[model samples]
Target: MTTAPADATVRVRYFAGARAAAGIPEETIRLAAGATVRDLVAELGSRHGDGLTRVLTACSFLLDGISVRDHGITLVDGSGVDVLPPFAGG
Candidate 1:
């Protein structure tokens, strides 16, 4: 399990649908120790409003370019997390 600091700040990159919803490509989210990606999403939802929930649920997490299928993945300071939603096309 990875431990985070009380002042930990992680860089989050929003892609595809998530980017469109967030209206930004990236942001630095602060959290307490042991904060997970899920936690970050919840926090973001609160800041951005309830509509974020619908979009966040469809997004997958990535750490340093590696997919994090596990929702329990711990987040720490300086970590780079990517939010990627499934692409829809013909």
Candidate 2:
């Protein structure tokens, strides 16, 4: 895993199955300066194990309330990243 500078952090919020997989509602992920969303996902997958990695594959992401489909997008410091797993319909 790449080491992050002390001040670089991204807040990750997990929902539904993602929350279950991560075993937490939210967490602060340390990242290298100019880290992208893909970097954060990769790091999370590594830290949380296979369950979260699986959940992440099907999950959608929101960066600071805006929907993001590209994992290559760069994450700003103190940004909020929400992980939303697919929902079942009635």
Give the winner by lDDT: 2
Judged by whole-model lDDT over C-alpha atoms, candidate 2 comes out at 0.91
Predicted structure 1, TM vs. truth: 0.85
lDDT of 1 by residue, 11-68 (tens): 9888888888887899988888888877888888887776666899888888878989
lDDT of 1: 0.83
- Per-model clash counts, in order, read 0, 0
Per-candidate TM-score against the hidden true structure: 0.85, 0.89
Please give the lDDT score at residue 36 for candidate 1. Answer: 84
Candidate 2 per-residue lDDT over residues 23-53, each given as its tens digit: 9999999888778999999999999999999
Clashing pairs in 2: none
Residue pairs with colliding backbones in model 1 are: none
